[model samples]
Target chain A: MLALGVAFSYTAGWLAPSRLSAQRIVDALQQNAGWHPGYRRNHAKGVCVSGYFESNGAAAAYSVARVFAQGRTPVIGRLAIPGGNPAAPDDSSPVRSLALRFDLPGGEQWRTGMNNMPVFVVATPQAFYEQLLAARPDPATHKPDPARLAAFFAAHPETGPFLAWAKTTRPSASFATQSYYGLDAFYFIDAAGRKHPVRWRVAPETADHTDAPAGPPSKDDLTDDLDRRLAQGPLRWHLLVTLGAPEDPTNDATRVWPAERPTIDAGTLVIEHAQDQASGPCRDVNYDPTVLPHGIAISDDPLLAARASAYADSYRRRTGEEAHVPGSAPAADATKASQP
Target chain B: MNTHPAFHPLARVLHWTMAVLILAMLFIGVGMVSTVSSKHTWLLAIHKPLGIAILVLAIIRLGVRLRFRAPPLPADMPASMQWVAHASHWVLYALMFAMPLIGWAMLSAGGYPVTILHGWPLPPLVPAHGALFGWLRLAHGVLAYVFFLAILGHMGAALYHGLIRRDDVLPSMSFPRREPSPPQMSDAPATTQASAVGTALPEQPPEAQPAGDPASPGQGDAG
Candidate 1:
């Protein structure tokens, strides 16, 4: 019976603390990181861009989603540094993120938020909450104590793999050269009535540029590099869909599937231009992964649903702040309304 | 039904094959729900393919059983015992069929594909829906408990017949009884070997008394 209780404590999401909701988790994260007013919630420092996704028609064989029908669809994307600080230096952060929205016909949109890291740190939302609490800064020092962090690792040994991954993964030179992974699995139903669980990753067409920087890195290093690259020509990435094997852990994003699994090169994503986040298409949009197209569905991974709720909470908090930030939200809306 | 001394060879083979498979499946099922270990990923891999195999084999067993007539119960046995023997066999068969289908449907409703190989896809048997998945999962879990209890009862009854009653019922489905010639002569005298062979082939036209009598000379061969 004690063993069963421990099993439920680690695996079952429903048995988590009743007071802990998506809003509460996000609020706790923001508080621990020291909240920055008038900034987007998690990935606060970001650049938005407009692009086109050209499907190779191969994705249609796996999913009947209209967006994968071998044509170019307008896409709004955002590149960001992970954390809640809007003014965090780009060179200081190792993990970067990209949120994409593929706007199909009939207002049907497929939105996904991905990070450069291959997997998430924790398997369950409750554990993630505990992680936030562990890393919370001391009231006097205003920084997390090393002792608290050590105790956290001791209690939750499952987090060791993610920490090792974070330590080993090198920072990318530019967002265009980084491969962003969708950490959760999604179900893709083909026309033949077969549903397969799949996870997606945007693999940069350009070779990795992980060599040491030529000069001292600045606060806007990534953004400057992205601008320089887009001026020369359109930047491209291949959206690869990997089929999950039965042995692959579908419910846990903290664990990754083996690299030997087969992957389909679904399509090419072409970035046309990069713009400031406050006045770009990605500002008003919330990249909720659960808002999928007809043929694509969310897998039973608990983290997927938790992520959707967290994104919703983040979206609500940011939008509610629009009244105070006159230059941020309304300006983007005005510019969009004036465009074709 | 009274003529055949033991079960058909095909029936016996299916019974033992299913026994091992079902026992393995039960352990895998218990292991899956008991913990949140990384090994569960591999356990799930073994479970889906094994369940499908059991489903396919159970259908064949049902067909083989329907085609062949089962041997009669001991003539001296009570009617209630006979009724229980008949009813429990049907229930066991029903559970063997129902368990796999429920598992398949639960996975389908949850929008998870039941694939064996990396590229080989087992098509969804039901549409993806959250509420249906919840209900199907609950039904699958409840049936698992019922199936476990039924297996215990089945094993208990088999032991009662084999050890306490010293009857042919247990051996009928076992390996030693299905051979063409009786091996009872190893222990019994050569003259009684003919009687042992006769008891083994009670399939003589409707003379149920001589063949199924538990107290006959062949009873010595049972031990």
Candidate 2:
């Protein structure tokens, strides 16, 4: 009894809270790129959009999730550039994001925050955190210290391909024309409990894909462009899920599967309207990448958990500041106001 | 019940306040983990500061508990029951301190800020280390279940004393009444003399005796 008592006490003493580390990443982001109140720590500049995801039932065999059962699932989404400053010029960052929350049947929901990049910049959460630290602006120069960035690049060779891609790729003329990739791999659990590792991307259906003109960009270039497009008609994107082979890396998001892999056109995403984030339906949403329905599950990709944690922390900080800010409440008004 | 001595006023206040805070913390903790909705953000914001509040209260509560003597258990109560009561009380106190401290440390290891209010963040308790964070996260999850079980057991025991046993144990820590004190009979001597002669004498039932009289030093530390 005494031995058991001691063991019990020791075990009890070890209990701590989970996901406590997310705040540090947010803090690092704030340190790197100044804090913006009532805005996401990253991807602070964005436009909110409401739409519907019409599933074609092709993905039903891969997952038992009801969202894939050939139906229209209402979606609220946000499109944004990768930056901490909400007022940052759209041309400043090469990476763009498309985050969606699908309101499924039976009140179930699936949320995913995807980016335009084909793969993530880092392999692990630690590396990502370190990258944030390395990219922190020097106090004297107001720019990332070249020495620190060089040191980081030398240490992580895997970042070379992403850096090369970012350097060469031109920004898309509009958010509606860019393909958004879910860099992290996930498991689609079938009805038989079989797990199929897959990566997904939303390909734009618009035929007028073009690069932005070479000139100084407006601060609201992306949002304004999206607004103009929405004024004409609803924008559409096809959801494509790529099946991975057994040898494909599931844990490292930096690695990509073979281009020859089979791809499934799971559904079509129709974004009907766009509005300013402050008064938009998607303003209050947290598109955590891990918020999967019953048929979908997160894989061993470390970035997924890191993204979920950081998104949660970012969500908490912004919402806490929401009450102090005006014109940032009640999505209903914004929905009606943005309707054409 | 009127004869039973009430718990120290400060202890009672702390007990009740901590009770409410703890219950709220448990619910908030559960909600924060289960959902990734927009509501999760505010839940977490409330959780961080609330945890720190519980930590601060637990320290003060522990100090208050140690400084004042608790009322003695009824002499007729079984020895096993007395031991269980004392042991469980200590366990509750242990958990009250452990949960918040571990949470703070886990956050520190994870390199996260331990913000209490909106803008004020506490200093980290440990240096950032990923391995330490993983271990601490597991420990925190396991302990949460244990803490929940302990809370249920404590509530069950409290109800048993209040309803089933109908003993003075429950009332001892309850809100005090405004009744005048009994005569200055030096109730300490009477208690010592009765226990010395043995509780088996059957002349008076244990409930009939003055429960609040200055208890013997050893028995006064029942919890």
Cα lDDT listed for each candidate: 0.69, 0.71
lDDT of 1 by residue, A268-329 (tens): 99988999988776776677776677778777777766666676456545654553422223
Off by over 4 Å in 2: A1-20, A324-340, B1-223
lDDT of 2 at B135: 55
Q: What is the lDDT of residue B157 in candidate 1?
A: 73
Steric overlap count per candidate: 1, 3
What DockQ, on C-alphas, does every prediction get? 0.01, 0.04
**DockQ category of candidate 1:** incorrect
Scored by lDDT, the top model is 2
lDDT string for model 2 (B119-163, tens) is 235777887554465456556656776776666666666667556
Q: Which ten residues in a row have the lowest lDDT in candidate 1 chain A?
A: A331-340
**Model 2 docking category:** incorrect
lDDT (10s digit) by residue, model 2, range A167-195: 89777668988899999999999989999
What is candidate 1's CA lDDT for residue A269?
Answer: 91
Interface RMSD (C-alpha) of each candidate?
A: 13.2, 15.9
lDDT of 2 at B117: 43
